[model samples]
Target: MKITHYCLSALLLFAVAGCDRLEQDMLSVPDDTTLDRYGLDTLKLGDKRAEVGKQLDALLDKPMQCTPGKTGLGDKRKAYLLEECSGVPVAGEVGKLWGEKLSFFKAVFVEDQLCSLELQLKTSGDYAALYEAHGKKIINLFGKPDEANAKGVRWQREGDEAVLKDLGDGNISFEIRNKKVVQALHHKG
Candidate 1:
C-alpha cells in the first residue's frame, strides 16, 4: 500500500546517505600520527642529500661516511653509514622509536636524493622477544602489515614502504623507503 511504498523510499534514501558518509571517511587522508609512526616527518624519503645530512648531523654522535657506488638495483647510489651511533634518538616528538635502542643507522641516496633509511636495534639478549614486542608495537600503531613472515614484516602505503626484519642475531633492522622514487629509477634504466 501507500505506507509500504513510503517506508521503502525512506529506507533507500537513508542507505544512500550513509554510504556517502562512509565513502568520505574512507577516502580521508591520514593525519600526522601516520607520518610519525614511520619516521617520515624527520627523515623523509626523496629528500636531497644535503638536507638529510643536516638532520643526521643534529642527531648522530659523529659524522657518517658516504660511499658512492651502484646499488643492487643497478642505480648509481650514495650510501651513508653511522656504525657506532648507539642511543642516538632520531624521530621527532616520539623519540627513540618506542624507546628501543639503536646500534647503527644508514641512509641510501639514489642520484643524490634519499631513497631509504635503515636502523638496527641493539639488544643484549632475547632477540626474538624484542622483535616480537616491537612488531606488536608497530602493528598497534599502523594496523596489520601488508606482508609478514617469520623473519620480516612490511607495510606499504601509497608512496612509501616500511619494513622490520629479524637479522637472526641480537638485532632487528627497520627500514623505510620511497616506493615511487624507487620505481621511477627502475623504469629509467
Candidate 2:
C-alpha cells in the first residue's frame, strides 16, 4: 500500500530503550542499553527501549518507516542523526547532496516483519530545494525507497523491504518496531 505524509507522522517516535529483538542482532545490547547510550537518569513508563520499540512497531506496520531530517519548509531547520543517513540523495552518506546544502531535522526508523529499514521525512524547502527535488533517490539508497513523483505530494522511496515517506510537513521522527512500513488506510488527511 502507498504511504502518505499524514500517516507517516502519526508513527514518528523517539527510541529510548532496548527491546529483546535486538538480542538477535549484533547491535542489540542489554535492557539498559538506551540508558548507556543516551544516559537516562530516570526511566518513565514509556521510557523503556524495548517497550518503545514495541509500541512503535504497531505504529509503523506498513508504508515502512522513514527518517527524514533537516527541512526548509516555510522557514525552519531540523536534523535527524539516524534518519539523516537516508535523505542524502547519493545512495549513501548524509552531509551535502552535491551542489545542494541542507540541515537535518530528526531521525526515525520504520521497520517491517523482516526487519527491513525505511526512513521518513517531512520537508518544505532547502538550500537548493535539493530535498524539494531529489530526496527519494537519496533515501532509495538507504533501504527500500519509493519516489512519490506526484506534484504537491513530495517524495517517497521503497527499498527491498523498507520505505521512506515524505509527508511534506516539517518534522521527522523514527521509532523501533517489530515490523516495518505500516500500511496506509486513507490518502487525504
Candidate 3:
C-alpha cells in the first residue's frame, strides 16, 4: 500500500507539471493586451485589490444580491465553495489554481465603484476565525490579480459583479470573495 501511494504521488506530480505547461498555453490564448485589460498579473496583486471597508459597503448596498447564477456543479462543489466562500463574491467557485473542484481558493473580490479583488484560502473549523486570520489581510492588500499568469484578478467597476469562468481546462477563474458568498451565479459549468 505504501509503495502504491508513493507511485501514485509521483504520477500526480508529473501530471501537475504537464498540466502547468498546458495552462501556460491556455493563458497565452489571451494576449498581453487582453490580459492587461483583465488585470491578471500572476506575479503580484497590484494596487487595485479590494478593501474590507469597501466590501462592507458592497454587502450593505441597498439592492438585492445573491450568487447570481446556478448552483452546485455537484453536491461536492456546492459544499466546497460554501465552506470557503460564504458572503462576499456574488459568484461562488472553489478549487486550486488548476481549477479542480476540491475546496481551494487564492483570490477574492468586493463590488463597488472600485470592484476590488483579492486572494483567499480555504479554512477549517470556524468561519469567523478564518476571516480574521486571512480575510483581513486580503482586504488590506487592496489590489487586483495578474491575468497574464492565469491568476483571476479581473479589475473593478461599480456594479461590475464578479463571475467564475472555467476555460474548459484544469485552469479556472477562482472567485475570491471579501466576505461570505451571500449569492452566486446559477449555471452549470
Candidate 4:
C-alpha cells in the first residue's frame, strides 16, 4: 500500500511538470519581428479598438477626453488629446523635453485601433533647436531618419512612421502614423 501511494504521488508530480512545460511551449512569444519591435505603452498596431481604449485608460489613469469624428477617416476613428503618462501626472524625462512647449497629443485610432499620434507645439521656440532636439530623440528610438529636410525628419520601420514637422506657423507637428493606414486613407481620398 505504501509503495502504491508513493508511485501515485510521483506520477502526479511528473504529470504537473509535463503540463507546465507543454503550456510554456504552447504560449511562446511570437516570432514577428515587427510586433516585437513596435509597441508603445501596451498599444500596438492591429489591436482592437476596445483593447486600445482600455490601454489608453490604463495609461492615462483616467477616462480620456475623446472626440468622435463624423466625416473622413474620422468617421471610423476617435481622437484623444493631451494624455499624460501612466502612473505619473507629469511626463517622464524624455517626454518633458518636448512636452513642456508642446500641447497635449492628439492620438488617432481607426476601427478602434491606434493608427496615429500627433502633437502640436503651443509656441514654436527657436525652430532649429526644437527640430534638433526632437529629431535626435526620434533617431535615438527609431534609428536614423529615412528622410530629413528643413520641412521635417521622418523615420520608418515596418510600415510605421515618425515625423517631426515644422508646419511654418507657431504650430509644429510631431506625428507618428501607421503606414498601411495612411495608404488606405490616401486611396480613399
Candidate 5:
C-alpha cells in the first residue's frame, strides 16, 4: 500500500512539472523568423473573423461591422475597417509596428477567414524618413525583400506576401496578403 501511494504521488508531481514546462513553451515569444510568414503580431493571415475581432476588441471604438464592396477585389469580400480609430489607441505587439502613426487598419475576410491586413501610416513632411524607419523594422523581421524600389518593398514567402509602399500622399501603406485567398477571389471574378 505504501509503495503504491508513493508511486502515485511521484507520478502526479512529474505530470504537474511537465504541464508547467508545456505552458511556458506555449507562452514564450516566437523567434524573429517564425511569425508564420506574414502576421501583425497576434493577428495572422488565416484567422477567423471572430477570433480577430476578439483579439482587437479593446482597441476598437465600436464593434466592427463587415461591409460589402469595400475590397474592390470582387463582390465576395467582407471588410472591417478601423479608419480614424487611432483615437482609441493600440497596445501590445500590433501597436509596436507603427505606433501612433497608424491612421488606418483594415482586415478583409473571404468566406469568414482573414485574407488580408492593410495598414496606413500618416507621416509628416519627412515621408522618406518615416518609410525608411518602418522599412528597416520590417526587414529586420522578414529579412531582405524579394522586390525593392524607390516607392516600395515586397517580401514573399510560401503563399504569403508583405508589401510596404510610399503612398506619396503623406502616408505609407503596408499590406500582408495570403496569395491563395487573393488568387481565388480574382479567379471567381
Candidate 6:
C-alpha cells in the first residue's frame, strides 16, 4: 500500500510539471513571419497618412495621383490611388505578366490614416485561374485564410487583414487593411 501511494504521488507530480511547460509554450508569442509582416511596403496598419504618404513619395519620387475622397460605395471612407507605382508584390505567372499587361492599384485611407491598400489585375483570358492560383499562393505565404467563400478569401493576424476577391468579368482585387477598419465596414453593413 505504501509503494502504491508513492507511485501515484510521483505520477501526479510529473503530470503537473508537464502541464505547466505546455501552457508556457502555448502562451509565448510567435516570431515576425506571420501577418505582422504582411503589409504593403512600409505602409502598415495604424500608420498616419502623412507618414505613409512620405514613404510613398520616397518610393515613387513623386506625389500621389489623387486626393483621398469618399467612394459612396457604402464604406463611407476616403481613398487615394497610387498609380504606376512599384507597389504591391504579385504572385505566380500572373505577377510576371502584370505590369507588362494591365495593372492598377490604390491605397485606401480613413481619417488621414492608411487603413487599406488594394491591387487589381485586368485581363481577358485565364482570370479565374490566375485568381485561384494567387489565392493559393497567399495561403502559402501567410498561412490559411481566416475566412473563405466563393466571393473571396481573407487572412488576418493581430488585427491586420488581407483579402483576395474575384470581381467577376476577368478582374481580381487584393486588399489588406487594419482589422478595426474592416470591423467598422462590416458593422456599417
Q: CA lDDT of each candidate?
A: 0.52, 0.27, 0.29, 0.47, 0.53, 0.48
* Per-residue lDDT over 1-189 for candidate 4, one digit per residue giving the tens place of the 0 to 100 score: 332232211221111123343233324423334343343435665566677766545434235566554223334553322222222234421122234344445566655666776655545444334433443333334544456554565666777877766565545666667887656552122
Candidate with the greatest TM-score versus the true structure: 5
RMSD each, Å = 13.9, 18.7, 17.8, 19.3, 17.0, 15.0
Question: Regarding TM-score, does 3 or 5 come out ahead?
Answer: 5
Candidate 2 Cα deviation (angstroms), residue 185: 19
lDDT of candidate 2 over 1-189, digit per residue (tens): 233432222211111112222122213322322222121112111233343444333333222235433322222243212222223333322332133322231223322122222333433333124342443333322221123232222212221222233334433322222221223211111
User: Once model 4 is optimally superposed onto the true structure by TM-score, how far is the C-alpha of residue 85 displaced, in angstroms?
Assistant: 17
Q: lDDT of model 3 at residue 154?
A: 38
**Tens-digit lDDT string for candidate 6 (1-189):** 232232211221111123333233324424336445456544576687778776654433234465434332335464433212234433422232223232545666666667776666565535334433332334344454456555666667876777766676656666776766545553211
lDDT, residue 58, candidate 1: 52
User: Which of the two, 3 or 4, has more lDDT?
Assistant: 4
What TM-score does candidate 6 reach? 0.47
Q: In every candidate, how many clashes are there? A: 0, 51, 36, 1, 0, 0
lDDT of 6: 0.48
State the weakest 10-residue window (summed lDDT) of model 2. Answer: 36-45
lDDT of 6 at 108: 64
Per-residue lDDT over 80-133 for candidate 3, one digit per residue giving the tens place of the 0 to 100 score:
221112233333433222122223222332231112233233323232333233
Provide TM-scores for the models: 0.51, 0.21, 0.22, 0.48, 0.57, 0.47
Instruction: Give Cα distance to truth, residue 80, candidate 4, Å.
Output: 19
In model 3, the worst 10-residue window by lDDT is 7-16
Error of 6 at 29 (Å): 18
Q: Model 6, residue 129: displacement in angstroms?
A: 6.6
lDDT winner between 3 and 5, please give it.
5
Q: Clash pairs of candidate 6? A: none
lDDT of 5 by residue, 1-189 (tens): 232232211221111123333233324524546656677656777787777766655444444445543332444464432121122334422232345355666677765677787777656635334423443344445554566555666778778888877676655677888886676554221
